[model samples]
Target: MKNIIKRNPNTMPKPVGEYSHVTVIPRNSELYTFSGQIGNDLEGNIPVSHKEQVENTFKNIERALLSENLRAEHIVKVNIWSVEEINWDHFDNVWHSFFETNPSMTIAYISALGLPEIGIEIEILAAKPSE
Candidate 1:
């Protein structure tokens, strides 16, 4: 059985999805944490737009999740980083296309990504109940 977990927030807009903005799992569940994923495609070329980068990053996370027979819905926390502050509108469009709901998020603006063409990176933490 799966559960929805919501974390603390005060006087802010409610999340636009069925999921809580954050989630907590019991200690018994199996946990998985992924390294930060950048915008580079499998060929090692980065995409030109923020939307493209975000899409690629999400795909990468999905691939990782599949390896464990989990899905994006299992994600408990997400940290997003961008070379410049993300434009929320652009991000929202990209986000909605891929994720049916938003997971818990922490977003940051950074001076640079390790690669010049990279615009975004996403790190994820997820859990699934042990069989």
Candidate 2:
């Protein structure tokens, strides 16, 4: 995280949520781009409720990060897409539990995701300095 730079410029309006507007990764860092993660568990079970799905999605994301030897601090950007309205309160609660340094993020409400049962999907870009 010390290698990453987060900025919110005075020229732009304040962000409405717990995220920065820009993120800069360290030079020669190893970057990871993940596929959008849904609420499916390791057993491939997708939850029915949006809240449950949201929680599961983050769990999956954590697993994904760990697979690459990365942690929340290594994240530089996040993108969220939802078919249903996001519960910001619950979302922020879950988000805060994972991220300490605010990361650049974007969210969009869409008609649908990869599957009808999927209410939300999240993807991330992460960077860590190369040894």
Model 1 lDDT per residue over 1-131, tens place: 65545464666678653335547786578888889988778897787988788878877887888988988777888887888767778777767776665678877789887777888898998888655
lDDT tens string, model 2, 60-112?
A: 99999999999998999999999989888999999999998889999999998
What clash count goes with each model?
Answer: 0, 0
Error of 2 at 69 (Å): 0.6
- Local distance difference test, candidate 1: 0.77
Please report the candidate that would top TM-score against the real structure.
Answer: 2
Query: Residue pairs in steric clash, candidate 1?
Result: none
CA lDDT of 98 in candidate 1? 64
| lDDT minimum window of 10 residues, candidate 2 | 1-10
Global lDDT of each candidate:
0.77, 0.92
